[model samples]
Target: MTAPLPSLRARVTPPDAVSPAPTHGHPPLIEVDRLSLYYGAARALHDISFAVPERLVTAFIGPSGCGKSTLLRCFNRMNDLIDNVRLEGTVRIGGEDIYARDIDVIELRKRVGMVFQRSNPFPKTIFDNIAYALRLQGLRRKSEIADIVEQSLHQAALWEEVKDRLHASALGLSGGQQQRLCIARAIAIKPDILLMDEPASALDPLATAKIEDLILDLKQQFTIVIVTHNMQQAARISDATAFFYLGELIEHDATSKIFTNPARKQTEDYVTGRFG
Candidate 1:
C-alpha cells in the first residue's frame, strides 16, 4: 500500500465544499420539491418536499413498505431501472435538477453514491473491490488507486483490521466487515451525496455500532440520507429525521424534536410505538 498522506481529504475536498442547511445565505444542498413516485399503477410516494443540508445525517424512518426506500431511490434516479417506475417531481442536487433531460445519469451517480440494506461486495479481492470504481472512472495509475484504496479504508475505519490482507476475498470477511467494506467502496470516489437503506439492520449490535460511527464520520464529507427501521439508531446518528407512513411524509424535524415534540400526532404516535 502507498504511504499514508498527511491529509488526503484536504487535497481532494474543499473546506466548504457543500452548502449548509437553509439559512440567511446558505441554501440547502439538496431540494426535493412536491415529489411523488409510482411503481407502475401504484403510487409509492405522495407529494414530498424537503431540503437536505450538507455535511449532516438525515434519516428516513418508517414502517416497512412505507416508501422510505422508494424515496431514497429517487435521489439518484435508481428507480428508473425498475420496470414501470415513474417519478413526477424535481430532485435537485447542487442546484441542478437531476431529472432534467440534459443530465448525465452516469455522472450523476458518480456524484451520488449508494449503500444498500445488505452488504454486497463484488466477488473480488478486498483491494480490487475498492479500486474497481476508480478504475472504471479512468484512474489507470496503480499508485493512485493504491493510495485511494488506503485512504478510503482508513476513512471507513477498516484499515487497521484489514490492512494486512488486502488481497483477501471480500466474502471471507464477517458480516460487519463486509458492510464496512461496501461503505469503503462507496466513499472511494468521494461522492457529494450518500444514500443508505437500512445498512445495519442485518448486523449484530457491535457491528451496527461501528456502521453508525462510520456514518457519523462520513457526514463531514458527504450529505448523508439514511432509511432505517431502528428508531433509536436514527436518533443516535442523524441530525434530522423524517417520518413516513403509507407513502406520505408525516413530519420532519431535528432528531430531538422529532422524537420528543413532533408537530404531528401521527409522528408522535409512531415514534412512541403507538402504531406502525
Candidate 2:
C-alpha cells in the first residue's frame, strides 16, 4: 500500500505511525452510510458511504452540481435549513447520528463551522467579525474574545496582515484578506470540523495559494473537508479525495492513489482532464 502523505501524517501523528484510513483499519471520525439526499423532489445524492479520518484534509472533487458540496453540507447539517430537503440513511460524527432527534443544531454548528465559496465577512469590523460567533455563544469578556480572535487569525495566517487594523471595517480588506478573515471567524469558535465549499474559486491565484496554505496548517487542529473543482488543488493538500458524479460517489481513496492510479474509469477521466 502507498504510504500516507508525509505532510498530512506529520501534522497529527508521530513519525513512523501508520496513517489512518478505513481500509488501513483506523476508525474514522465521520461516517456516511448508505446516505441519500434530496432537495424537494430532486434527489441530489445517492447512497454515498465513506469514512473521514480525524484531523486530516479530505477533498471532494467533481464537476459542478455533482454532489460534492451536497455531501460537504451533510457533515454539519446545513441542508436542514433548506425547505423540502430530505435525507435517507445516516451521517454519523464520532459515531453519533447527526440527523437523530434532539441534536442541537446550534451546538452542532459550533462544532462544525462552514466557509462558503464567496468571502462573507459581515459588515462589521474585522475584530467583530471574528468575535460574533463567540459572543453569540455567550462569551462576553472582552479579553477572552480578544485572545481567541488573535489566535484564530494567526491560525488562518491573516493575523500578521491585519493585526494593526483589526478594528477597521472588514469590507475594506482585499478579496483574499476577506476570505482569510472569514476562515478566521469560522475557526474562532474552535470547531472540530470545517466544511469549505469552493473557498478559493473567487480569488486570484495568489489569494488561492494563501488559502491553500492555510488549509494545510489547519489540519493540525481540525478535520477539514473541502469541495473543489480544481483537481490540482485537491491533489496538493488533501490526505484523501472523494470524487462525485451526478449525485453519486464514484470514487474515494487516498489523494495520491486517486490522482496517480484511480480505480474507476470516471475518476481517472475527471482527474486526467479527459472530462469533468
Candidate 3:
C-alpha cells in the first residue's frame, strides 16, 4: 500500500519561522515604488510603496475602499481591464517592470496569480478546472495533465478531499472546497506571486481557519500578498503587515510590531480596535 498522506497541519510551517527569499540580495519578488492609480477623474491609490519578499506572506489591512483591493490588483495589472483607469509609477516582479511597454499582459497574469473574495470555479469537472490552464498552454498528454492536476491540488492542500471525485462538477464542492479549487487552479500555472483579496471573508469560522492554514502552507513555495479585514488573522498569518488609510500607506512593518506597538498612531488605533 502507498504511504499515508501527511496531514494538512503537518504541511504548515510554524508561524514564527521565515521562508527563505527566492533569490539572495536581489530586489524583492514584487516592488511597488511610488505607485498610484486613478479611475477617470477619481484617484484610488496614492504613492503606495512596498517590497514583497518571496516565500513570505504580506498582509494589507485598512478600512473598506482604502485601496487594499486596488493595490492587490495592481501587482498583475488587473486595472488595465478597466477603461480610463490610469496607473503611475512602477510595479516590478523579479526586477522586471510589469508596466513597461514590452510586457505581455497574458503571460504576466500567468506569472502573478490572483484569488478573489468569492470563490469562482468553472462550470466543469473538478479535474478540468485544475487542468484548464495547462490545456490552454497546449499540454496534450493525458498522463502529464493528470500528474500536474494532482500535484497542484496537493500544493493547495486539497488533494485528499477531491482525489476520489475528480470527475464531479466543480460547483458540487462546498464553499471552502471551491475556494481551495480556485487556489489549485491558480497554482497550477506555477506562479511566483499569489494575490488574495479577502479570501476568507465569506467562509464560516471552520472553513476560514482551513484557508488560513492553507495560506501558511502555501507561503513555503509562493510569495503571498493578502488584503484582509481581520486584524487577528493578519497578526496570526502574515510575516509583514502594511496599514493603509485614505489612499496613503500609514505603516509597513513586521506583523508583531504592527499589532503590539506600531510606529504610527493610525496603525495602533486600527489594530487595537479603536478605529478602522
**Each model's C-alpha lDDT?**
0.85, 0.86, 0.84
- Sorted on lDDT, highest at the top, how do the candidates line up? 2, 1, 3
Per-residue C-alpha lDDT of model 2 across residues 126-184, encoded as one tens digit per residue: 99998998898889999999999999999999999999999999999999999999999
Each candidate's TM vs. the true structure?
0.90, 0.91, 0.89
Per-residue lDDT for 207-273 in model 1, tens only?
Answer: 9999999998998788899999999999999988888888877667678878987666677778989
Q: In candidate 2, which residue ranges exceed 4 Å CA deviation? A: 1-26
Tell me the deviation in Å of residue 77 in model 2. 1.3
Output the worst ten-in-a-row residue range by lDDT, candidate 2: 8-17
Between prediction 2 and prediction 3, which has the larger lDDT?
A: 2
Query: In lDDT terms, how accurate is model 3?
Result: 0.84
Q: What is residue 95's positional error in candidate 3, in angstroms?
A: 0.9
lDDT of 2: 0.86
Per-residue lDDT of 137 in model 3: 69
Stretches of candidate 1 off by over 4 Å are 1-26
User: Largest lDDT belongs to which candidate?
Assistant: 2
How many residue pairs of model 2 clash at the backbone? 0
| Candidate 3 residue spans exceeding 4 A from truth | 1-27
